[model samples]
Target chain A: MASFDRHRNRRDNRVDTLSDTAIEGKDPDFDAWLSQQLQFHEPYLDNDGFCEQVMEQLPAPSRRSERRAARFQYGAVVAASAIVAWQFPFDRVWMEALQQSISLYSLVGVGILSSLAAMTGGILAARR
Target chain B: MDLNDGDLIRRVVDGDQRAYAQLVRRYQSQLRFSLRQLCDGDRGLADDMAQEAFIKAYKALPAFRGDARFSTWLYRIAYNLVMSHKRKKAPDVDQEAVDRARSEESVEEAQQLGMARDLDSAMKELSEAQRQAVHLCMQRGFSHEEAASIMKLPLGTVKSHVNRARAKLQTLLQAWREEVVSGQL
Candidate 1:
């Protein structure tokens, strides 16, 4: 096991350079030459303009006005939905009132129960 | 101005656009260097790829789990984008055409041209797994373990691909040298 460990360590230590040579089959001279060539080619490629282009495409959350506008839009939707939901039960009751005789107490009771249920649901969702 | 990349990402997630710009300035150079290497010195393509990477990273900032360095996470995005570009879009100068062009140049020019061709050839010849391992390890300077995370591969598998790709590239590069010298490429 000790001998095996020693052999593995030796193999691991030389792997990068040795592998470079063995796989390339170039003499050590050619390997050295290629390495130099790689270094030389490194600088010829210009890549300076990368950042500005990327920055331009990023979604800008720059201004407070934008935030306010977004918030207003969000609030408008929520308010519209709330208004629709609030008026829906009453709309049904009004239709029922037109169709037949209605008791004020019964209509008030139904409205109170529906409003309570909606309030409870809204509160639960908000907590979550 | 002096915020680290992680801090910038956090700020960006919190809707701070200026912090995002600062992050871009800090990483743009290194990203370009990495992309230039991957794109075989086509600065325009490298710039496009780097831009896409940053935009993607920015959009996905909220989902970043912070397990790796922000640069590592960004490099993973860049590497994936480059790989997709290579696979989907045809190269402007394909290897055969580039080799033909290389044959006409002086020895030093040939050497310069050959390095890119050889590296490109060697990289292209690799299996997808092997290519990814070599890209993460050699190109991005990730350790095998780090590459495993980026690649979502087992550590041993990443190690194996890196070893295999290195060996194969050595053989292919050596053959390439002989061919170029003999005018047989």
Candidate 2:
């Protein structure tokens, strides 16, 4: 403990000297001190097998382009759906079905189910 | 002759996985070290972030214009990953462990161990941007402009962070200078 306190006192004196030097505009000592302290933490990462690990983790190069193509396909499908909805007499068919035994809620439910079915089919087709 | 980074990048873009591997090997240490510092000396987390950055870089390689040096671009990716990770889980720098390490007696031993502790604790005290700026510019020897680009901060902000970080570090590690003055270091 005595040794520890002594060491601490010595360190305190050095800091005072450097602080004075810094005030005098001879900052080289302070800069050197800062550099030494910072350099002490320079990390040397052990990188054996790092390259192999990264290589294994990289997605197949085509995967990115495939994702882009998938987006384009989805967009085309949406555009085609809008054109068909606009051009067809689907509103008349929907109203007629509503006038029949089918309630409006049932018709809406059916539409949702069919959309889900189409999405499932599209996913299955892509997988195949 | 070793291919320059641009050539390697061109080959990788042209579907040469070997060239990509070379790029990975060339920058792995640098990226890993930067991540380690950014992660506050958590080696495992640093390596994980580095790996994620490399994979992300590979996927985004096509979008990489040759505007920035490959290293600066890569560092940017790693820095982003570190920042995202920090958002998910705030990393706790173990100051107690650092304090324990500093309790050792010999001046040489204390200098070695205390400096590490002081630096780590000092770093933890810094704002995130300040820490990144200081590590990139002061420790890693990146030019202020390069560090600014990597951090995506305005040049003035990066400069301010570096200066403030240096001042904070000086105050934190004043004992080291004291040790030097005492002729004990």
Candidate 3:
């Protein structure tokens, strides 16, 4: 058995990875014998730049989690926007603001802003 | 860092190409070796299939749910590739009938071939299912259930495949024991 083990060691390292009787109903002797024969045939193929070749040919690793997170974030934003749109009467608020803008105080503020804009434009035009 | 397969796969999902490369380096030998067995010692075909399997695994990495070991999943990919290649190459070959027809004949041939070409060639006589079961269960240290997962076969089917394969490869078993006793191995 020690010689068998020695032979296995001299061969592939991964042989005998499991203990004897690792699998139920498996004959340990038969398992060892078969494993040894299998080991004899098994070769530890070198990488030989295969990894690099595969890497070079790989399309790219996808950032799935990032994509998923982005999707969730976008979904949440849309959902939030929809909720706000549904929960708040934005149309009514807009109409009310528009109605209020037509009042005297808004007209006075607009007139002041218009006068200020005209003064600024006149000063800039004069400088030019 | 010597990260586990899970961590490496996680990194791969997160767009770390180096992590996927590490995963490839870790399993390429064993996967290629297994594919070589399935390819009937066609190393080029095995390497090509192995490369394709790795690329497919990389592309499908994000969908991997960590339910099975990464290596097992990768083996499953490789096995599917081999089976698909076989199907495409021999579209009319009935695998079930071939398995049944070769069950007894494989043993007889293994005994004869074991004398000349040794174990690997004798292994070729076994049906693809049995050979895959033997390779995964014995050489690769996967449990029967793990092998079933990798082969995408039922557990009982995988177990029976291993049993039937060992029965067919009885010649190799005897030759091995004899060689070990004689220190010929």
Candidate 4:
């Protein structure tokens, strides 16, 4: 329990670094006294097995699962896109893209981006 | 090396259960003590609230941007839980237990008995906002701005709470001061 009794050894100098400029206007006397009193009010309560209780009650590690779920979503979307592309008439689409405003540089850029995406997915899976 | 709170938090967010245990250990006492005061010295309820807050923070850890101090953020969670608990209108704390907790004393501790007892009772008389503000700013040594953030009150309102709380405490404790002057306590 927190009480006003000073914990004998905790704080060496009660006013060492508390310039208290944050609250500086009036009642310097009373403020300083109150500060001293409060500094001594509750020096560090003992753990008393509370930490163990909290740790025991904590739900299992979740960030890894969340990450795994996000990766799975990304993989699923990429797989669906791949399936759709595989079913589409890619040669005609390429011919149309070539005939359209799409430049050689744009095609090369898309190819490089696709390769990089595949590489990223491979690295992520390897790490997993 | 002892990891700082930021490192511990990052580790916890990366699925390090032991890192989170370290955080719970580091903050449990201070958090619980503050909750105890807010719960009117109901240690059991305070402990329960503290536990719940830690669990909530754990579930929300991945989203905890380091915009505020970890302790302040934890306090905000605990304060919110306290507010909801109060809204449910739980039964009042055992008054006898509260009095005994507040007035516990020893031979050497008797020197502060008069002043401490008066301050404790006077603190109970304060509005909840005033009490919280005083605790965060005065007792915990947080700046008024930090207290405002924790309480989700305006900066001016927090300052007013501290000022009003102090004014009341000063008045209520005047007799105790006079007695000290007269060597009565």
Candidate 5:
């Protein structure tokens, strides 16, 4: 069968060298055979549930890690709140002291300068 | 702007999980269908390859620069995975078994005009690429040019492959026809 197969392959390669007349002679049978090739596709397979099954096999996303993340976030919020409470006494009281010592005109000028500075910084950041 | 696939790709790159799932749902069927040809009706392997392809695509999404169609890039990835799979488990693809399966289906679709049972055995004998070329033409109804694009081959190369495959199939069918004519089949 191996020898026969090799011989068959040789004959098939020789087909390219055939004259136009011989090629034309082979055309009708070839066309009929080509039509038969089209027949194999007639009964298309349905893969309806295929996607669902594939999606099912996907490694589930790490829920345990998500829970850990949530817990860490909650802890950070609590820690931040406690720090703020410890520092809260100075936040308002210091502002009152500054307001009392600084003149109204200087305070207004400082406030305007701060606003201009913030606007310039925002524009630079927006350009990027 | 009508959301481009590139936009969806950007969102997926930005860690939008829902956007990634939308991409999956959009392409799953076509990818599965292309892979079904490679797997030889082993739906499980096809599914595995498809999911693996998408996951790999997700991992590599950051590098996608949006020059080509997203589906085209995804197809290239899928074909690579399918090729690697074939290398690993080089399938024997029992022709007789495939023919039996086709014949069983043909019995039900006997009323159709071109539902000839004889082509099943002939088709089963084709090489994987040859079978793929034929399926892309007949089943997917892709023109020779469209198939070339989908298969990522030069148009002339695709034409030659399809022509040679068709010729081989024709020879087998001719023999089958002779057997039938002689009342020997």
Candidate 6:
């Protein structure tokens, strides 16, 4: 907490310094030059039809309902998967299959596949 | 009376397409221009990033608490989008080369080109955080607090970035300042 406070105090000091530099006429010529340069770049962009393009790409106003439905669908999938996993011996079956195919090549293949799956899952989760 | 940003936001939250349109129209040019500067004048990539930012803003509108100004929030979304895009691409060799080239351009050489171009080149020479700080506070009229929120940095960090950016730009554009004093710029 002390560290956080120290950080906050430092930031406050910097903010004060920035305001002084910009607003207190400390360097009026540079401030004026910056403002003028900014203004000169202001009229370069023409946003013709840009808003329309954004609006057109937007999902319809039924986004709330769509999102709700998506949540419901996700919940259903999770519930169904949980039920099947609880009722089935899928894990035992997979272990037995792995035992049956217990060879150097098979183990190496499984290791590679597991690594790939983990990597893919990590990437997808990171994106989300 | 003109509808303020909050009112437009409220209407959009209530699913008013026209209100959202008004909000988009109000900010698109500024957002695009800022994104262009961030992307180092890559107009196409900037426009795409701006469009993606607006769409994300629309989707996230219901969660907006209005603690910050709408413009600040919009800029925050844009900044995040650009940052995420940069993360996905990973190695930005080209941008580094461009930055190196711009930094190499002397004040006198930039002055010979023109003040506006010189300013733009000098801006590209700043570190990313400094550039965003200057762009938001100096160019886009965001307060330091607002810029801090938009840049998702500590307030002090934003302030330091602004101060450092200003100092660097002041040094880089000193020649241009002399021209301005002479009424040549």
- Give the DockQ ranking, best first: 3, 4, 2, 6, 1, 5
Instruction: Give me the runs in candidate 2 sitting further than 4 Å from their true place.
Output: A1-41, A61-128, B40-42, B88-118, B121-125, B172-185
TM-score of 1: 0.48
lDDT over C-alpha atoms for residue B16 of model 3: 65
Cα lDDT listed for each candidate:
0.66, 0.72, 0.72, 0.74, 0.62, 0.73
lDDT for A16 (candidate 5): 50
Candidate 6 lDDT over A13-120, as tens digits, reads 453354454533368567666977876766556767788899999988776854654455556555655675589685676687788976757766876696566555
Tell me the lDDT of model 2 at B110: 49
TM-score of each: 0.48, 0.56, 0.60, 0.62, 0.47, 0.62
Q: Which portions of model 6 show Cα errors greater than 4 Å? A: A1-25, A63-128, B91-113, B182-185
Going through the candidates in order, what fraction of the true interface contacts does each contain? 0.24, 0.31, 0.43, 0.36, 0.05, 0.34
Off-target runs (Cα >4 Å) in candidate 4 are A1-25, A63-128, B90-115, B171-185
Per-residue alpha-carbon lDDT of candidate 4 for residues B32-144, written as tens digits (9 for 90 to 100): 98998788777778899999999999989889999988988899999999878977866764677666665653332455554565465566767989888988887777889
- Deviation (Å) of B142 in candidate 4: 2.1
| TM-score of model 5 (CA atoms) | 0.47
CAPRI class assigned to model 5: incorrect
> Model 1: runs farther than 4 Å from truth?
A1-47, A62-128, B40-42, B90-135, B151-154, B164-185
Per-model TM-score of chain A alone?
0.37, 0.42, 0.29, 0.33, 0.26, 0.30
State candidate 2's DockQ. 0.13
Q: In terms of docking quality, how is candidate 3 classified?
A: incorrect
Q: DockQ: which candidate is best?
A: 3
Error of 2 at A37 (Å): 5.4
Per-residue lDDT tens digits of candidate 6, residues B1-185? 47999998876776676788888888898999889767765666788899999999998998999888889899999999988887887675357544554565344344443555656666776898888888899888899999988888899998888777887666566666666678885
